[model samples]
Target chain A: MLKIENLQARIEEKEILRGINLDIKPGEVHAIMGPNGSGKSTLASVLAGREDYEVTGGSVDFLGKDLLELSPEDRAKEGLFLAFQYPVEIPGVSTTNFMKTALNEKRKYHGLDPLDAAQFLKLMKEKMKLVQIDQALLSRSLNEGFSGGEKKRNEIFQMAMLEPKLAILDETDSGLDIDALRIVANGVNQLRSKDNSFLVVTHYQRLLEYIVPDYVHVLYKGRIVKSGTKDLALELEERGYDFIKEEVDQAIA
Target chain B: MDVKSNLKTAYSQQEGNSTHLASFQTENWKTFSGMGIPALKHEEWKYIPVKNIFKDEMNIAIESSNLEDTIIKKSILPGTEEANTIVFFNGRFQADHSIIHEKDALVVKSLETAAGDEDALFVEEHLGHSQAYHPDGVNALNGAFASGGAFIKLKKGKSLLQPLIIYHFSDSSNGFRFSQPRILASIEANAQITIVETYINIGGGESFTNEVIEICTGRDSITRYIKLQNEGKHSNHTGTTHVRQLERSNTHAVTITLDGAIVRNNLNMVMEDEHAESHMYGLYLLNGNTIADNHTIVDNRMPHCESNELYKGIMDDQSTGVFNGKIFVRKDSQKTNAYQSNKNILIGDQASANTKPQLEIFADDVKCSHGCTIGKLDEDALFYLRARGISEKNAKALLLQAFASDILGQIEHEAIKNYIEQLISERLSFQA
Candidate 1:
């Protein structure tokens, strides 16, 4: 479903993603774990086509399409979703209107008729039940004065509305409590299907325990050094990323 | 000939017809010639190019207006269907074209008639009081030709059933049309009224409108005033709305400037009595070569008066925006609470925003704060919207609307507010 071959990227003059190669099939969830300054979020930002990140050398093929060539909106229309770690606080743009715009744009891209007001509200109500966000929150400005957990849940709600082919969760679990974590994880699990995939980028294994991953990779210094099953996340959580750093330094030496 | 000499010649031609106000007319015209068009070196006229707009020959269309009733009916502000409609064509009041919906609630008469007959004391006390704040030629020029202006008064202790909509239109088919419209309104004690002022330019010829509206509010009265300026790009406008609270009155004014060649608005709120409250809100959305300058003043003359002022601007293309908000707390105005803020967003490279928030407090027990901001649209906010599958254009419009909604939210009239919102959306959608 996705292919990244030596996806080297940088912000400003500082290289973040040195050379990352990853291949994932449909219906599978992949978790990339790393310490601070390990390019975990950088990799996610590059995949989502954030303008600030410069891809120095590499290729990202999503469903056989060159993903880097598309604009951010085009990438979104192509069924690429990024759950920002820190969702933006947009005052005056209500969540319902914002989601309606996205849903209509994506639907229009695929030659589908736009949903009317009642139909859109009905769909939003169903998704709100799934994401456990109240109706008032959707009516207010998007992410403006929202708690951290509410922001994460709103990201998940947006994902449910979009139903992307490739979902990239960039530190979405950092600020959520146990209850919010289960709700968010369950929403992702419910959306998981053979035609869709998720790239769960997190710093802790606690999120992996709720939504078990098919594969876990330890990323260090912008490179995914090791790949294993879900047990690897637990092991890394117990031993800490220092052991991974030592392994990387020893290998480099 | 120079603009001042041309204006002097025009003023001399009109002074001969007036009998009751001949002295008043000549005095103001002398002031206009004495002050003339202020140069750019002048502090208040620094960024404003008032001299350029007045350089050409401008003749006040004093000829009795042959405007149709249909024109006045069509020009009534939306949502004011039940309102008392007052119409102005070529700076002169069109009485036949106006409609007084409620007969006894208020009285509408010609400025001279109102000054000489009923409410003569009000005319003597409050007429041309805006000149105290704006002593420039612009203010005096409007006062110099104040004939055919409107005189509106609300009955004591009686609130109107609906709003009073004043429509100012410029029919400039003959030549470079010049209009001077003066309004003297008095709301009696315990009365309530909402006054809305909107403008329309009917002809293709270039036009300039200089308007001054002075309002006096009695004790415990509530007044809401809204000014909407959306004339075409060929028109230039300078308007002053001066409101004085006699004692413990509440006044609210909102000015929305959408488009014009050059527009200058002076909104002054004089809180003269104890516990008087006022709010001044404005929004200007400019594109093309439009320059919208909003100058507002809040004067707290007595103790315990509170005033809040906020003016915002969004300038696109090579448009320019200027916001100057001044708040004054006099020595006798102890415990006065005055707050003023101005914010602007420049959407184009050449688009410029100039903001100055001035606060002068002579009272030791006063709380006064002023702030101004000028910035470009937040690129991060733009990216966030685009990432959600909205097109770049839609995203930009959404953010700009959001930035403007705080000001747009001040409009109390539902239909008029929505109408202005539609115009703002169209203005914001422009991209080059």
Candidate 2:
């Protein structure tokens, strides 16, 4: 459902993602694990069409469409969802209102009628149970003064609302306790279907234990150095990433 | 004739017509002639070109024959039908057109008649009190024509359910129109009142409204004042809303400027007694070549006085916005608290904002803080909204609406607040 070839991206003069290539089919989950500053987040940002990072050389394909040519909003409308590492706090904009606008916008893009108030409220109530989010939290300003766990759960709630074909989870496990991690994972696992895919980016294997991935890829210095089954994540967690770094360095020498 | 000669002729014609305010008018006319129109070099009028607005030949003559009842009816704000309506046509108060529903609790009379009647002492003590702080030719020009103004008083210990709505209509169809509308209101002890001021201009010709509304709050009284200026691009306005809070009184003022050619507003809160409190809020949402300048002053004269002020601006296209907030803590005003903040967002490349905060704190025991910021919209917030599938245009509109919500929420009057909210929503093309 998604493919990236020779993706070379940089922010300003510093190169971040150098020669990244990945492919994922429907119903498959791929995990990208790397050490700090190994271009894992950069890869997610590039796919989400963040304008700050210039893609010097890249071609991304999503369901046979050139994804790199679309704007960030268009990409979102085209069923690409990026769960931010840190959700922005926007004052005076209620989460419910934000979600309503976003949902209607995507519906319009798909040539569908917007859901009525009753329909929207019903869908929201159903989705609220999946993420275990409170209605009062959604009524307040979006992410303004929200706790870390609440913010992540809100992100997952939005992901569920949009029901994108492909969702990218960027460091969603960071700053989350064991309980929050379990809740977030449960929500994601419930949304998983044979027609949808996920690219889970993380720094540890803790998140993988709850929502086990089909493949594990270790990124080192802007390139994936190793790929294996879900067991590789447990192996890396026990042994650390130094061994992988050493192998890549030896290969370079 | 030119505007200067025309004003001079008008002044001469009305020199001795009324003995009530003749000496006051003479003194103000002298001040206006001496200062002539304020030049750009004048510190108070540096950004606004008040002289240029008068370059065109203006008809300062008072004429109300062209104004029809239908026009007044159409111009009345929705949801304010039960309000006590006070009408002004070409700067002259139209007693025949006004309607006062709460006659027992409220008193509305012409300034000239009030100055000569039993309310003479009250009118004399409060009229032109804003001149002490402003001390400018523009303010004095309005004072020179104060005879055509209105006097409003809320009886002691009375609270009116319906607010008083003052509509200033300027008819500029014949030529460039210049109008001055002045009002002085007294809220007696333990009384409560809400005053709303809005402007309406007839015809496509350019119109200038120089207004002054002075309010005196008595002991334990509460006063709510709202100024809504949404006149067309051909209209210009300069107005002063001076409020004095006596002995534990409370005051709240909100000013909303939606559209104008060049608008300048002066809002002052003078705490004359201990434990007096006041809140000042303003929002100027502008597009096109509009210019909205707001100047606010908070003076803590007595001990234990408190004041809070917040003014926000959203400038789009070639619009310009300016804000100057001043807070003063007198030597004897110990335990005084004052806070001021001005924030602006520039949406267009050519849009600009100028903000300044002046604080003169003398009392060592007072708490005073002031801050100002001018910049573009938050890029992170914008991207966060756009990434949610909202169009860039809609995202901007949503963000701007949120930016303006802080000031809009300060309006306590439901109907007036909703009316202004609708106007702002349409201005920003924002829904929901």
Judging by DockQ against the true structure, name the best candidate. Answer: 2
Residues B1-432 of candidate 2: C-alpha lDDT, one tens digit per residue:
777888888777653645447778889999999988888899888789888888547889866556789999898888888999999988888888889999999999998888888998887778888999999889998889988889999999999899999999999888788999988888999999999999998987899999988999999999998999999999999999999886789999999999999999999999999999999999999899998999999989999999999999999999999999999999999999899999999998999999999999999998888898999999888888888888888889888888889898998888888988888878877644
In candidate 1, what are the lDDT values of residues A1-253, reduced to their tens digit? 8999998999999999989999989999999999999999999888887889999998989887999999999999999999999999999899998888889988989999999999998999998889899999999999999999999999999999999999999999998999999999988988999989999999999999988999999889999999999999999989998998998999999
Estimate the TM-score of every prediction.
0.97, 0.98
Candidate 2 residue-wise lDDT, A72-183, digit = tens:
8899999999999999999999999899999999998999999889999999999999999999999999999999999999999999999999999999999999999999
Over 4 Å off in model 2, which ranges?
B15-18
Model 2: lDDT equals 0.91
Candidate 1 CAPRI assessment class: medium
Question: Considering summed lDDT, which 10 consecutive residues are worst modelled in model 2 chain B?
Answer: B13-22
- Deviation (Å) of B23 in candidate 1: 2.0
Total backbone collisions for each predicted model:
0, 0
Q: Which ten residues in a row have the lowest lDDT in candidate 1 chain B?
A: B15-24
Off by over 4 Å in 1: B1-9, B13-20, B430-432
